[model samples]
Target: MSTRLRIALDAMGGDHAPDMVVDGADIARERCPNVDFLFVGDEQRINALLDARPALKAISQVRHTADVVAMDAKPSVALRSGRGSSMRLAIDAVASGEAASVVSAGNTGALMAMAKFVLKTLPGIDRPAIASMLPTMRGDCVMLDLGANLECDADNLVQFAVLGTVFAQTVLGLLEPTIGLLNVGSEEQKGHEAIRTAASALRATPLARNFHGFVEGTDIAAGTVDVVVTDGFTGNVALKTAEGTGKLFGEFLRRTFQSSLLAKLGYLLARTAFNKLRQRMDPRRYNGAMFLGLQGVCVKSHGGTDGLGFANAICVAVDLVQHGFNEKIRKELALLQESLQAASAAASGSDPQAVAQ
Candidate 1:
């Protein structure tokens, strides 16, 4: 029998957990036929969803935990103190080699804490940055530190650029991903000290300099670069703002469509065009976020995400595994670490769980 892409999903971790998670599982099954899902959560609740559906009824389940960590709860507390929580189980499953990937639309912090504690980061990767795809003019470009690793230094940002570049090449299928330091200006010395420092380091480094430079906020959705690297503080804000703007603009379009009979007629005439725009801006399409710099694949979904978001996250997981993300990233990271060491004539390490100093 062919081996399935085994995945353990946190059914009770997200805002729409269990119900949305279950529906997402169904969506994945219908779409990614090669994947084998194992929902980890309350047995009765999972069974209730499974029993409600015929195809899903045949799917498997692993009743790992009985509790859940709320969205706002601190991840350290949840991962450390909340014993046997659903998110913990899912991360533990991947760490224990029980599954190939772990999908959590739950607490971002909680999920990251558990994954870092469990699967662990790849060697030489100081921290695992979460990179989510953005709806850019050219297509989807990656924006790093979406919510993971809130406090990052210049070195960490450089590492993210290295990681993001490989992610762009392998996952996004970019031939030579243009690396950009998310900055206030395109000038080399434009951002914070950390950013300016990172830009210099990035330029000096051979691996990252491949189609590399600096990018400003205006260049984000405009597609000036393939990868946008920045500290978590900046990157997360940029991502959220873009998300909010997209939603608000879409709402405006909908309101305008319903404002008047003339507008409604315009909508009818441009119905196909509007549908295309909707597809491009749909939050569901870019719902997946890869926890970059990890040894194995850990794709994070939005906690408030629903069935469609879940499906998109699953597709992200499948694509990464299918394209061998871990293996590819390993080489790139090693190259970066080695080059940094050689160039500086000193050991510069990116150790996971390393002190953030």
Candidate 2:
């Protein structure tokens, strides 16, 4: 059997459709020569795009499908009527073991719904969390529940922490990654009961050696922890706010530089430094958001990203597959379960027994 990784692509799902998807595949192919692709979309459109990239054509196969899920379609509607859609077909490829992973720049809700229905959650996981790497002061940090579960309980938060920890170790190559719960303050008494309970559980587990307690919003950029754990609601809001702040900062610098002749001349002198800053802040470098805790690998690319951004998403999938991400998660989760059960048993034993009447 061939050891090469095969990835399924939803070629008709993005704003730019087959063109961007095909071009991205070409870029990713160049980077990962051993990887093959199965493109699911309108065969004619995909072939037309591939005509210009003979190299990509040699490593890719097209699975024809004319149906596409609309960008604004409700998840329920897509689930009910999108059986033949490109996104669903691409996910099906993974479920059927035809591909190692699936990538799509499609409707977020529809993609998640379809993927969950098709691939199902990993054993011992109640829900899959959305995880992505963020550029931090120290380096990249993994954050989870990025708009996946809006209302998570203490167990869910703990589960997300385990998922994020495994991601950091597998993808980031960290030996012992530190984790933190995102809260308003770092004190033990702060935040909701769910977060506090999750914190206590983490501290009592094997993960406590690397757990950094609670961290605030500033800690995200400061890289206070290797992983940041939170509910989907807070994580989504934090991600958007950080994105907007970065854009605003860029705009402010642009206006400042163009304010006068002297400022423009100063900018020219610092052009190299500014270029490095631009590269560091480029969103394309971090375009892929992984659906962690799934039985199979699924990466969601930004719907409006360009070929380069989509290529990064493809790279994320390939890395997850090669690194044995899901297997690692399962092993870690099993250990976590054992530790929690043992702790529960100890607590029960310590409680006084009721007298027989």
Candidate 3:
């Protein structure tokens, strides 16, 4: 809290536009006293909302941008024509050092495209993967490549493990978080070649001690590992499935509680427990999805989320900034790169030093 962090908010990016964005910032202001906000959108609307919250307004500034990225905008088209859009300007703030991070509840693909183009990937990182936390029986689990790359090779998967590991350490406060590669089965011989190769590489490196190898889909909810790594296509599908399942479960519970007079009586008796369960499974608590591997922190909030959800996204950006998440990732990756070079040398029957060069 000693050093004030400036976070850029894409005021026109979300479904609710400046209203949700400003309300979210107000909530964030109460939680993070040392943080300042840069609201990028139409100055008039943003200021009008801020006027109602004098305390938040005191620590906020607005940058007028007439252009807004449509919720359904194509990533390709947005990248080509959204130069002065609110989302793009917010990202530019981070790249230009005007802000410590950028948060948006915008089109996921467009945000990813603009962020990658503006912030670029970290050194030794080929692509930035989408990472987010999932509520699990053992607390929370970190999963990556939620929807970044549709198809990834072995190397991409390897990098995702590294990214997920560092993220767990930084955010989850785990000294040695176990990692697993998502697959059809937990057997070593299962899954496609890319996943198997990635698993082998992870096991051969220093990360082997913390690597739990291949895990099935059920392992994700079971918290079989602290980090789950997979290609974007698979990871995205898993994420959506989990979301749908949560919704379906809630609906089933509602119907069961309303089935009959006996059921209604039972619901009253279990209301307290159900309340606790609802709090534990609140989607707002896990609204932020980080685009890891970018040079600057870029958090993507769910586009349709409410103010509370967006506020949680702001908190995520603050946590990453305070923890120096990118620095930790770079340090871990440096060590991993060295280990990989040594393994390559051993495979080729060459000197490790020469292979590194």
Candidate topping TM-score = 3
lDDT by residue (71-156, candidate 1, tens digit) is 89987798778668888888777877888888888888888887888788888788999998897889889989776777788889
Q: What TM-score does model 2 achieve against the real structure? A: 0.97
Estimated TM-score for each candidate: 0.93, 0.97, 0.97
Clashes of each: 1, 0, 0
Candidate 2 backbone clash number: 0
Residue-level lDDT of model 3, residues 1-357, one tens digit each, is: 287899999999888878989999989989988999999999999999999999999999999989999999999999999999999999999999999999999999999999999999998799999999999989999999999999999899989998999899888899999999999998889988999889888877778999998998999999999999999999999999999999999999999999999999999999999899998899999899999999999999999988999999999999999999999989988999999988888888996776579
Candidate 3 TM-score over all chains jointly: 0.97
**Model 3: CA > 4 A from native:** 353-357
Candidate 2: where are CA atoms >4 Å away? 350-357
Candidate 1 Cα errors over 4 Å, as ranges: 346-357
Query: Residues 1-357, candidate 2, lDDT per residue (tens digit)?
Result: 667889999998889887889989989998987899999999998998888888888888999999999999999999999999999999999999999999999999899999999999988899999999999999999999999899999999999999999999988999999999999999999999999999999987889899999999999999999999999999999998999999999999999999999999999999999999999889999999999999999999999998999999999999999999999999999999888877876687742232222
- Which prediction has more favorable TM-score, 1 or 2? 2
| Candidate 1 residue 253 C-alpha distance from true site, Å | 1.8
